[model samples]
Target: MTEEIEQFETVLGFQIPEPLRTVHNVHRWTRLGNSDEESIRSIIARYIEYRRAIGTDDLDLLRTFRNNGNVECIIQYLRQSIRPMVVNTLDNSVVLICQPGGTDFHALASLFTSRQLIMFYAMLGEYFFQQVITQEEISGRESGVTIVYDLENFKITDYLNPYSPIMQIFRIGIALLQEYYLELLRNLLVINSGPIVRVFLQLAKVILLPKAFEKIRIISSSNMKERLLELVSSAALPSAYGGCWTEVDVENVNPLTCCTIRRPIEGKAPPCNIEAAEHVNLSAGKSYSAKISATKGQTLRWIVKTSGKTEFAVTLYDSKGKGEAELLIPRLTIATPLPDKVPEVGSVECKDTGVYGLEFRNVNSSFFSLKIRYGWVLE
Candidate 1:
């Protein structure tokens, strides 16, 4: 009995508790009895139906069976028709019977841990039972395991087949549910800044800004002289109008635009052409500004096209250091149409926070007049 119980445990991954083992031994003894096997089969069929009446479908459970009212009557009939025979099988052999008493039946449920894992198993078990009950064409011959076990002959004969239509339907239902939930979780993990921004802007339109345009807050502060140009000049491959407010993933190289509002330095005058030179040669420690009107979120870009061996350092601010702050000039260099590489964006921690501002430095030589053109974007 112990060996047989262990074999069942190996296959099911669960141990057969005490009283249940005793029931199994009794059932085995009855099977090997001298009377015809038909009587035993009839009792089993009646018990199965009684169990089905309540909520359970376990073929092994003979009493306290389903809540259905018919099981008690069946049990009474069995008691009268065939005396309850308890068999004692070989030491290592097993006999299937009904266990009337068991300690800690509820404790066995602990094997199922998480809610999600429990639901998964329940779905599979339900599918299996439903299939076996509904399918008509599935035959015992096609199913590998013989359904009924005949102890007298020590053989199992054809009884139930697992390939029924019921099982197939169950599988299909489970597959569909899995796919639906997986897709939902996938969408949640991916961040879509574009749509999120659009929704925010639309909501702001109705609540904050309405009827033409009123005084609004623009993040521009020149209070801090230290300038940091977050975005540098790069290939302006994107078309002017169509590319506004679009995002460029940091992992890749792309041109980002920024807007600068500037005024003349205390003593210095405006550049000569304002378009061609692309380079600025100003006295060290001087300040300058140009009239700027840019929507927030737009990137500002400066292209340098200067001749001679001179480097220019420029600073950008909102209102001469009074409002929100930004970094305009990240580094000092003579390179124009800035290289494809860009400094890391700003962050809250400091390493590379995306704020753009001005940088200060001296020029090696001086030029008569410098030309500058600036563009901004709201992305």
Candidate 2:
């Protein structure tokens, strides 16, 4: 592998980036039939060129994003709007499932330009890759992931139109995945496939590498559960896919919110540390507020679960009253707890020293009060 890496750099006329020089990645290249000098050189060259084109060549920048919690920040923002993609992990494989019908593409396009969305996707992919590699190091084994694409309700029109936002973003995302993470793909299971899915596969054949394309399997809804069980255990697979796992909220699915990290980095803070758990009775047409002092650079994390859907927001006020209070997280509707009892969780990094107000409002017209159990921590 060391000799192959040296030859790869010699052929490319420049040394590969430090992040791509990992033993796992070198083995991935070799496993993907890049052992020959010419093949290895060609694959590495294309990967480097793609990273440069996408402005993600600076792996250090991605590391910064991961360390500063920017990756989770972007994920939270996306979850509030659209949630077509959900990620989970099995024994040695990460599963990424996409449901095209779950997204509001028009709203997504209005919220973010194509470039912004593409960049976010790239960053998320990089984070996932990092996590997978870290797990490999810990387990002393190679790892890859499965992509389960559920096209049960996908609209062919939205995908076929060249000018559509969905089409534009989809094409770019596919290209990026193929160029950058093709070696990480164990197999792609297209479940609930139909005629439209077949058409899409035809298009994918053109975009995906021959070996990558061969990893795809189309499965109908009837036998999807049985077939998937062969690869993923009932404990790890979501119930929606014919498994026993029901922790994820399928109705309001978001990978960041639904999935738990298999192996959290040892030194970093957990996503949220609850310092207090208290209940509040919010009367109908009224609100409840909790205040906490936070300094700049500290992260404020909270989890709220109510008897019913409620309005929630966060505001930052000047500790000395020298300036007006700023709304950190705007008022948004928080859905009621799912059947699995997963609470809605959120966090934001403080940019100024101030008093942060976490407010919950009962918007229901009923005269009864809403019972809420909430927890928060500042770290």
Candidate 3:
């Protein structure tokens, strides 16, 4: 192996992808979040989070994925699968809709390995995030990404088998979309939701997040098109549903093999820390707060802004309310670029494992409403 590859394995505890062997290639993928060197413990914590998000307890499989630990195979089918992906013309959200009867489930499953399916998770993972978040007219008023699972002709055998690849892929997709891809998933709209889909979703609530599923829209097949058009544009739906793109054959895996078939919902959410969000409005001299509790080596990240006026300064405070914060950030006075209520965002590593407070101070004399979203790294 090359020295650079060896370095990647040693430092990140994984090999660099074949494409990212050179310094230039490393910098390319590194541009996202673009952090400096981190501790091994930090890397371990992140990997653990990924594993939980994908509903996988297989430590070895988690460690030895496609190219290495971080990067996975950049398969063409992933990008080519236009059936599930559509950009919302209204909110500009990425709509990953599942078309029932559109793709052959069994054949689709036969196309890729269980590893690659998860790699599809890793490859396209965080892939659309930067593009999704940055196109902000105003940072605070960001658009949302949505997943529309259209189970129009889905039968019980489709997802009943717990071991099916579709179920496996579904598990990974739902968990990761819920856990790692926080705040971005504005809604998980389920169109063409018949009794089965409804019951499936209800059962899924146990294995998945009740809150995330709360964002689901279980509409009838007849109303699916009209309802979706209200939120998304015709562009986001399949041509059969009045969009430009043609609906492809439903290609997925339906594992006929199964155990006791009486189960309603199949799996459960992976055990891990969750990202949180809340909406806040403040008046002049008033303040709002969101806090992240981090250990000695963990990191705390926060983003906040007011809708009416961007007159806000978000500061960090240690558990002790006595003085200024101990951690460091790039900016103290996070400003919204003129005309845009762009949020002031920053991340600071904790010096100690204590509950830290994030105070969104509204120095403005007038009242303003703001949304505060935050989370911290923990294992």
The per-model lDDT (C-alpha) reads 0.26, 0.62, 0.47
Regions more than 4 Å wrong, model 1: 1-287, 309-325, 337-362, 365-379
Q: List TM-scores for all candidates, in order.
A: 0.17, 0.53, 0.42
Question: Ranking under lDDT, best-scoring first?
Answer: 2, 3, 1
Candidate 1 C-alpha lDDT tens digits along 310-361 = 2233333433446644333222222221211111111111222233433323
Question: For candidate 2, lDDT tens digit of each residue in 1-379?
Answer: 6787776567657787866776688777766555676677677776665455444555554246433343443343332212221234455765655555444554444344333445566665665576567657667667777667776666655655654544555566566666567788887888776668768787777667897899988886677789888877665566767766554454434433233222211221123346337889988888888988989999998877677656677888865576865666645444432312235566789888878988889977778789888788888
The better-scoring model by TM-score among 1 and 2 is 2
Which ranges in model 3 have alpha carbons more than 4 Å from their true place? 1-89, 100-112, 137-140, 163-169, 243-379
What is candidate 2's TM-score against the reference? 0.53
lDDT of 2 at 257: 21
Q: Which model is ahead, 2 or 3, in terms of TM-score?
A: 2
Ten residues in sequence with the least summed lDDT for candidate 3 = 254-263
Per-residue error (Å), model 2, residue 306 = 48
